[model samples]
Target: MRLIIAEKHSVGQAIAQAVGGHMEKHDGYVQVGDDLVTWAQGHLVDLAAPDEYKDHDWDRWSLDTLPIDPTPDWQWKVSRDKGADRQYKVVAGLMRRGDVDMLVDACDPDREGEAIFRRIVKHAGVSKPMRRLWVASLEEDAIRDALASMKDETEYQGLADSAMIRAKADWLIGMNASRAYSLVYNARFTVGRVQTPTLAMIVDRDRQIAGHVARPYWKVVAPMGGWKLAGERLDKREDAETLLRIVNSDDFAFSIFKAERKQQHDAPPRLYDLTGLQKDMSRLHGLTAARTLSALQSLYEKKLATYPRTDSQYITHDDLDTLRGLTEGDRLAAGFIEPDAKPERPHLELTVNDAKVAGHTAILPTMQADKAALDELGDDERLVLTRVVRRMWEAVGDDYVHDVTNVVANIDPHWCEKHPDEGRLLPEGECRFTSRSDQPVSLGWHAIEHAAPQEDHGEEDEAAGNIIPANLAAGVSIAPVPHGGATLSEGKTKPPKPFTEATLLAAMEHASRWVEDKDLKAALDDDESHSGGIGTPATRADVIEKLIRTGYVERKGKQLRSTEQGRSLIDVVAPKLKDVAVF
Candidate 1:
């Protein structure tokens, strides 16, 4: 007989179904034919509390008991949740059952999941032969495939160790620093391994915004047929007027000095990692990162999507067959995919590399989601699922091909009146102007609206010029028209917008700038860095939510702003704890 332990009851049920187990339900567990299947509500066991350490005053939150450390014999206990302890007893009882000979660690396939299973087995003191079931999707075929290919549990010791270190580090910092700072300041300063530093980033940005000063500027533009070209921005108002007057004169002449047209292929976006999905959800639906994660998690549990906690945005080369089927595999996705849409060799190669993948491939829709089922989901859930499905098709899409034309001109006020007969004109010095535009050779992925269009404001955006057709070539002289009407328009600089959860998460992810030291910044920015981005992908949502729960951050609409209380804590907190570099 075999014993199967899953991360949760729903997953346990899925595993049992895939294995063709007999139905026999019991308290905290169920029996399936020759196997005993059980589930844990996340982690049934965790590190013991400070009070659990004998002969220590760490239980009290006082200055004397600041740095709590239960070293050497670090204690472990069933978590405080009533269900956890009750379920732990149930699993422990089954672990000793004479009928069961082999143990299967069927938890979520990630570092945290490894930790969860190891802690349970260790606490129960089970010494049976153990195996692992690593599944990227909960779909029946995927589960059965995983069960058939289970590996020895010892293979995952490295992952389990990583989780252990992460958990212990979090406990040490959250326990010690929170107590030390709170006692020193005589206020409840809820410091976190990730939360405090994240809060510090927002506070720093606010200070920069508060001190920002806006300056004024001017520019001159000329219209030729449909195209509009802008002159350089002039610091003085008189300089802009001089250029405008020169262009306004009928005698003014200019020649297109450089006219170049180049075509390039634009590649499609990669598949959605958790962070990338959170960003798009925030951008498209105004959904917070936490809300998006919650929706995606629900989809995963329902077998409509793959695992949601992954960091990789690429799939392995081996998953190509399944990845191909996913394109038009289910009826719901068929409607969104182009009829001829299939990922080409080049496209597949771009998104498939075995080396970088960890835990799971990027989030994607499963074949189980049909039209009716997809429609039954909430609007946000449907939106997320549709995006994943579309991205699968898009990731393999043909490149977006287009041509960019850059036309440069040199204008001379006196040359037009004197050299009316001349077709080719002067050297590079006088008021230089340039016009640029892109022409599409093929719509490719853009035809399906695979991604939203983001506007680009180049240097010539000063006067909001139009994209001129690629008509005028080098040495071609054209008379200036007033259609783009010259103006010395003045505008003030603007402060950076406050953080929305989307931008805040991005800041955390790409936070190479949070610190000055190159090595330290590189470490923080690394996905596998000890304290990357203030928090890991699994915990960042909760970190943001915790800030709001504790009033360290407040929601002003979709934007996150540090509250006065939160700001005050940063103000009085010790320099090292709050320091961007040291922290």
Candidate 2:
């Protein structure tokens, strides 16, 4: 008999159903044929509290208990989360069952999932033969396939070690620093290895926005027959007027110095990892990372999508056939997908990389979703599912092809001579103007993006400029229209925008750029999964939510601003704690 342990009750039920038998439901487990399935409500067993350590007075929030290092002799306890204790007992009871000769670790396929199962087994003090059931989707077929091809649990020991080290490091930093800082300030202050650096970034950006000073500048633009050319930005209005007068004159003619056209192809974007999905949802629908994650989890449980917590943006070689089917038929039947929009010559290879897909495949819609009624899903779930479906089709799309034309010209010599003072102000006695435009050769992947125009929020249309004439080539001279005189446009430099969840998520993902040390930055960037970020995709949302929950950060509409308390914490935090690399 086998005992299958899942990460949650919904997942447990899915596994039980996939096991194929009349399931006998119990208090917290289900008996299916000769096998039993159980679950943990997240981390049912976690590191013990500081006070639980008998050797230290770590319970008292004092500076003396500054560093809570519980290494080598670390203790474990049942999580205080609701019903965690009861669930632990149920799982432990099953592990001790005499008939259950084999154990199956069927938790979510990730580092945290590995840690969850290991902690429980160790806490229960039971030795049994163990196997791992790793599946990316909760669909019945996928689950059954996983059950039939289980691997020995020992294969994932490296992943478990990494998870444990990360957990302990977080615990030591959070416990020690939070207590030390809170005791020093006489107020409750929570600090974390990842959360502190993330908070520091917000606080720094807020400071930058607050301290910004806008500078004014002017530019001269001349209208040609079909297109407009712009002069360089001038620091002084008088300098701009010099160029303006030269272009406004009827005698003004352009000597085309350089005109070049080249064809360019924009490759389609890769598939959505969890972070990428969260960022897009925040940008497109104004959904929080936590909300997007929650919706994705629901979709995963419904077997409409694959696992939700993956960091990889590509699938393995084994998943290519499944991906091909997803690209065809109604597998991705979200209402947002246009009926005519199909990948006739899908580039499935663009989304395949065996080495990159460490555990779970990229977030994808399952075949089961093709027949499921999507409208029956909750509002957020439906919205999230729509995005996932759209992205799947978009990932395999052809390249967007376009021809870009760049032209640079100089005002006629006669005009410069007509206004000698203005000519002298110009660089090398010539006023230069430049214009660029892109003409679409093929819409390709852009067709999908264009079909769902509402999905793009902040993206600027590259092809929105005027059409450049084919005859306007190098060495050609054209007179400026007498009707449209050159004019000076004045504008002020805009301050950087505040951090929205989308931009903030991006900043967190590429945080290696913030580090000054070359070696440290390289070290951070070396890990493909992290991509130089402080936290994993699985933990980043929780870190953001924790910051908000603790009143360190506040959401003002879509913008995330560091609160007064948050800034204060950053201000008082030890310099090393605020460093991204130090974490």
Candidate 3:
């Protein structure tokens, strides 16, 4: 008999169905014809926690165990997740069967996936010849294809080694730092390769904001037609009042302002990776990053989208044909050519870069989706799938076209002088100018309607307002109309915003530059090094949520702020241990 072990029950069931395995209900196993199929609920076993050691008085948190290194003899235990013990018993029983010939690791094709299978098999003491079933999508056809092309487990030894190192490193840091800080600071403080730096980032931002001091500033305003033309004034309010008097005193002649048209192309947005999806969901629908991830996971399980926990926003050459076919008849597909459309010279430039992608391809629609099926999904799940489907169409769609225009006008002092109090303008000697742009054109992907803005907006909206219009040539003049007492604006130069889940994810993705050391960033970016700047996609969210739950980080509304307990922990931990580079 051949034994197949899957990372989770759903995947195992999918593979069993694809491989012509007849399902039968058994005590601890799913008897699939001659194959004994068993599943792990994520991880069936994990390294025992510090309190579980039960040996020394060190069960309580203390700084003495600064770095809890897991020795070769370190104990392991079954995970506390319900059904883990039963699943393990089933797997062990299947392994003990006399007719079993070999074992198949039909897990998700990633590092953590590799760790899940290895830990289970090692704990179960199974020594059978092992083959790996590495497939990206859970589609039945994909599973069958993977089973037909199974590779020897030895081929993934490096991946397994890397996964083991990551798990052990997390265990070392989380256990030691958590205990050390909890004891010293008298707070439940947890830290890890990913979480500590993220918390530190939030704390630093809060400090910068607290130290910021506001300064008063003045601006000139000219109302022309229905639009208001605004410009900044010097620091002195007296200077602005004098200018306002002069402009109001005269009626300025209007000249035709310069008008020039230029074509601009905005490439359609790249396909969604987990982080990108999370950011969009947060910005558009007020979905928390964790909530968005949950919806994406559901979509993946339903086969509506590709794997959702991936970091890559580009697909390989092999997936191009399927991608093209999936979007062929859709409304957005009218402008996009299929991959085979240009057969001899495929235009794969859209998502074909080999250097950028790893583990899995971008989030995309699987061939299994139908418009009617989407109606059955919950609101959040439907929203996530809609994003995936829209992104797929947009990725290959035409570039967004825009006609940008910059209009600048000189302020007339006489007009300002005529309505001194009404027109808040700079003095005649002070330089003044105003600029405006026509409404933006939405040519392609930008045409997709996003949800209307919520009543409560944030800094992101202010930043979006700062997009500059096209350049304006000098010497354009326009008529100035009386301004009705617009209040001058003032603000302090603000510090960076604290890391919301959205921003923290961005920081992790770009963690290479967190350290000023050039060599460290280079090493992290290099493909040869096992540790990328960010933690693995599968574990990054967990790391973040853990920090929040353990009081190392606190979420205030949408902002993530670090606690005093979190700061003290960082000060105590070895610098390298807190850095993501150590991973």
Would you list the C-alpha lDDT of every candidate in the order shown? Answer: 0.78, 0.85, 0.68
Give lDDT tens digits, candidate 3, residues 37-107: 77888888898887787775456555665566657767778988888887888877787778998999887
For 306-414, candidate 2 gives per-residue lDDT tens digits of 9999888899888999998877665564465666666678899999998887777889987767535587888888889888888888889888899999888887566
Please give each candidate's TM-score: 0.90, 0.95, 0.84
The sequence of per-residue lDDT tens digits that candidate 1 reaches over residues 461-489 is 53334566656788877777753355555
Q: Worst lDDT window (10 residues) for model 1? A: 421-430
- CA error at residue 171 for candidate 3, angstroms: 1.6
Error of 1 at 60 (Å): 2.2
Model 1 steric clash pairs: 22-33
Best by TM-score: 2
Best lDDT goes to which candidate? 2
RMSD versus native structure for model 2: 2.2
Residue 464 CA error for candidate 1 (Å)? 7.4
Error of 1 at 480 (Å): 2.3
Residue-pair clashes per candidate, as listed?
1, 0, 18
Per-residue lDDT value at 555 in model 3: 82
